[model samples]
Target: MYAYYGKEKIRMQPLHLLMERGHSCKLADIVKKCLRLDLLEKVTMKKNSALMMVVLLLMAVVLTGCASDDNQAATRTITDMAGNTVEIPASPQKIATMTGPSYEMVFMLGGKDKIGLVRSDHATGYPLALLTNSDLPNYPTIKGVGPQTPVNAEQFLDAGVDLVLYYNNAAELEKFKMAGIPAVVVNTTTTVPTTTEEYFEQSSANLKLLSEILGGEAVERYEKWYAYLTKNVELIAERTKDIKEEDRPVVYWGNTWGTNILSSYSRGTRDFEMELCGGTLVAPQEGGQFPEINKEQLLEWNPDIIFVDNHGNAPELVIEDMYSNKNWESLSAVQNKQLYRIPSGVFFMDKGSTNTLVLLWTAKVLHPDLFADIDMIKELQYYYSTFYDYDLSEEEAQKILEGWVDAENLVR
Candidate 1:
């Protein structure tokens, strides 16, 4: 019988011919078993052979193409706060990071080429020179967001973006949805993550995701940074594990210095870094976000160490001026001169800027005796060069450190 094959007609015999005609036919058996069908008419040997070859060739070609495409897709996965899973396309060529801190992650992953419009805040004070460049195609300039003004979605679309990576904030999620861009939330700010491994696992996973997205040469450099950071965290954890709980440094975090000043003490994702370093919060209380703290309450806690957030009522100045009159000399930190300022440039400098250098700085300050060998300046430069792709000179690092202290000293 003539069977239509593409543009040609081929003669074929039915499957019954194989057994009825006593034909020792391997081809017939294969067709019947593999294809799982019975031919209504008999097929000629030549036609049957050609059909089989065509079928196998078509499958091979299709499978080969599919495998190649699968390989080309960039493989990445992100874990959200609810433990939900998100897999990103491999090697995303156009990534638009909505959050400031997430931009750092993208840069660390070697995604400079793929990066599309970056958050406006990244344009200013971004430590890495490459990121700070205004000429880059993906980053557009957005100004006029004061201490409280929020960013708009239309501005992000104007810059030509693909993905918006950010921390999981309700207000942001709503805005991102309104913007109509694909969004993913990554939570790095946690007050207490319950386990030591749990604390860094998210961060390490984020770095891994970045490496995979960037792919090729960029992955190697990022891995080196990730390895170094992981090693240091492990070292810090091991060293501090043996110290008594009571011995851990008690700290206070000044969020801002305005009317009715607020501070975070073991709060939700806000003071995660401080909490992870085994530092106790000496504030109104623990586990609440940005609780209002009066001066009397701060003096009452009498923390072992105090860290000013940045540039406001400098903790140093507050101590110097109020110490004599406020009965602040009773605090242990006052006696030992442990009062210090978190480097504003690295910490409070930019909301979008992820100053990872602060982690090492925090580690060193929280456990000076254990981490006596740590050189914060050198470490800061290393991270600056590795993650930001800019060589943060020792002079620059020193200036940043001094700037924090100087901000306080100037008030006198």
Candidate 2:
């Protein structure tokens, strides 16, 4: 968390306190408070009526005094994929993050204090204190990504956020711009980045952009995160370098649905760690996307080891059903009993800061003979602490992963 001395304190809680004091607070007053804190640049109101303008100006004056940053804050205008120009705020105070994982990224980027509101689904695991506590104002929920529910422009407008962050197809910028919200789009949907360099570069660019939005001490803290991750990656690369290409195992990734989707170290939807650890995928099919292979293909390729992404406890039933079939038994991984469940916190998340850590930990796990000192639980606690600033006890982290497995069982 950033220091409490600045304008952040007002956005964080003082508004609720003012309301509780029996004074009816208006949004203009809050924006004034924001401006007084030097949080927002004063702009002439073109749409609001004169009466509203007086109230807003007063509020802006009050808020302008709240911002304490003495440094010359950085500002920039970046174009979205759709070519819309977005003028990013310097030290944005109230940011609405719509994408579920964008919340996680904001927290990782040291914008936890800057986050004014999060989408509903992202708030699922939020503690009661953030919402139910009378001392805090009720935060509005923005929309999320997926098929039916894309970004909600009205919700963004209603939130009055200075900036909005989400992960969506760049093509959806039109939907985003309709809200008149300056959005930062993190495109993680790209299933296959051409190379690991491209992947890290993209991820770092997102982090850098977010860090720029959250300047001052937040940027310093975020840099610490970058340093920590860089050190870890270097350690992982050096540790796994000894494992030769020929000696590396051919592994297949399985899910709870008894599906064996072949993975590769080279590129595509293949696990990123598999590539880092020199592991090759068995399926030799072209177009290395996540394709569902049948039992016949499983027998034909016969991967050396199987790593199930499913954290479900009794996924063994699905394993049993597959192994019971004669064709599945013919596979090398099935014959050797080398199949194991990959830890969910790392492999389970599709994309996030946690996903990157999972990649490092997975590289260590896949080549334990060469990287025997790898500690997944320790790594998890470190990532959670360093990035999210949330410490998880061993038991707690285990419960989350096991809980995921249990939930999958219930679904089955």
Candidate 3:
């Protein structure tokens, strides 16, 4: 057979002859036999062009996938106190504290600028937070989902919070997760430590985790604060370890909760604090953490000293009421005027970072002669300056020790 291509005439090869010649024909040879071209030659050019397009597409897809992976790598995973694995921004810029105390904790870690939201009652609960950080009150506040408040996921999402420090609440955590917010449960009612050692261990772990999340100077800050806390704990332990059981005065931590004068802390941190400071806890462990006892029970215990909670009523007013109330007149704490207001700044001294200072203060109150050398005022000054970067005047330090709030600066 023969064929004409434009002006040239080409001879066609017989199928049997082409097959017998070779299965592998060169490009020039295949083009020359245009009239006898096989199906393979017809599709070969199209197939190579299609494959090149596919290769370019695959390369584009792979490069795009790697970019996506790099974006995902921006976050890091951490296990919170509740043992939930949470992926959060490696360096979170906007932090929301759902718990009242966590605001102070984050603030101490030098994350003041990173705070975007705070608990509704944080201002009132922690007055010094507002006083020290002028911008604290400017952040949006939300009521946490708990026994008292309902969950509102929209509020968290609207705030653009990158990270949330919350109390252990599974429902709240789920809500936050659904809103695409990273939440960490740092505290739980069920995990309250019964001993000072356990409390310190948990507190130290929490501090370390928080420091890791915040990064930067926060790590060094946690180390310094923890060292100070450990040194003070060891000092107190060394001094009080030798005290005889009989010599340890019976101490009670009293609180006025919503017109109830009999409210007191039993077998929790308060009890441990009393034990560490060489004082006997007047409240028995069986009554629960915060128990309400009758006036008769108070008289029976006859606690040698009382540390009043400044959360509810002012410590001064609580002490004044206890002194005037005829039912409390016979109590040793009232009769001897041994009631002292628990010092609080940013948060209660009985809890949080200030608890270390409370250990020294309680020791001084219990055994003046033993801890007389420990200057609490200087300690407070140093703590505020070092941790919070706030230079507390001597007068302000004394006010905090006296459980006096800065009512003028307090967020209403």
Which is the leading candidate under TM-score?
A: 3
Model 1 gets an lDDT of: 0.55
Residue 274 Cα positional deviation in candidate 3, in Å, after optimal superposition:
1.7
- Give one digit per residue, the lDDT tens place, for model 2 in 47-87: 33542554575465434533432133323577543344676
Model 1, poorest ten-residue lDDT window? 15-24
Candidate 1 lDDT, 1-412, residue by residue in tens: 4455345554333433222222213333444444544442333334677667744753444333444444554244666543446554444555666543555666655666677765454554433333333345346555543223465766655554545565555675566565444456653444345675765665565556556556786678666866776776677667766767787788876665532224544454334556556677655545344566767777777788776565354545554553454456677777787766666453243232333456667777888777789897887677667656667777787866654333322221
TM-score of each: 0.64, 0.66, 0.78
Better candidate number, 1 or 2, judged by lDDT:
1
Candidates arranged by lDDT, highest first: 3, 1, 2
lDDT of 3 by residue, 1-412 (tens): 3333444544433333222222112222333343244633443332465534533553444334444445555577899988999988767878887664677778899988888888766755566776688887788877544433556867776676778888677876787776557899875444556666786786677777888999999999999999998898888888999999999999877776644657876566566667788999877565754678888887898998988876565667778888898978888888999988888778666666677888899899999999889888899899989999989889888878878665333332
Q: By TM-score, highest first, what's the ranking?
A: 3, 2, 1
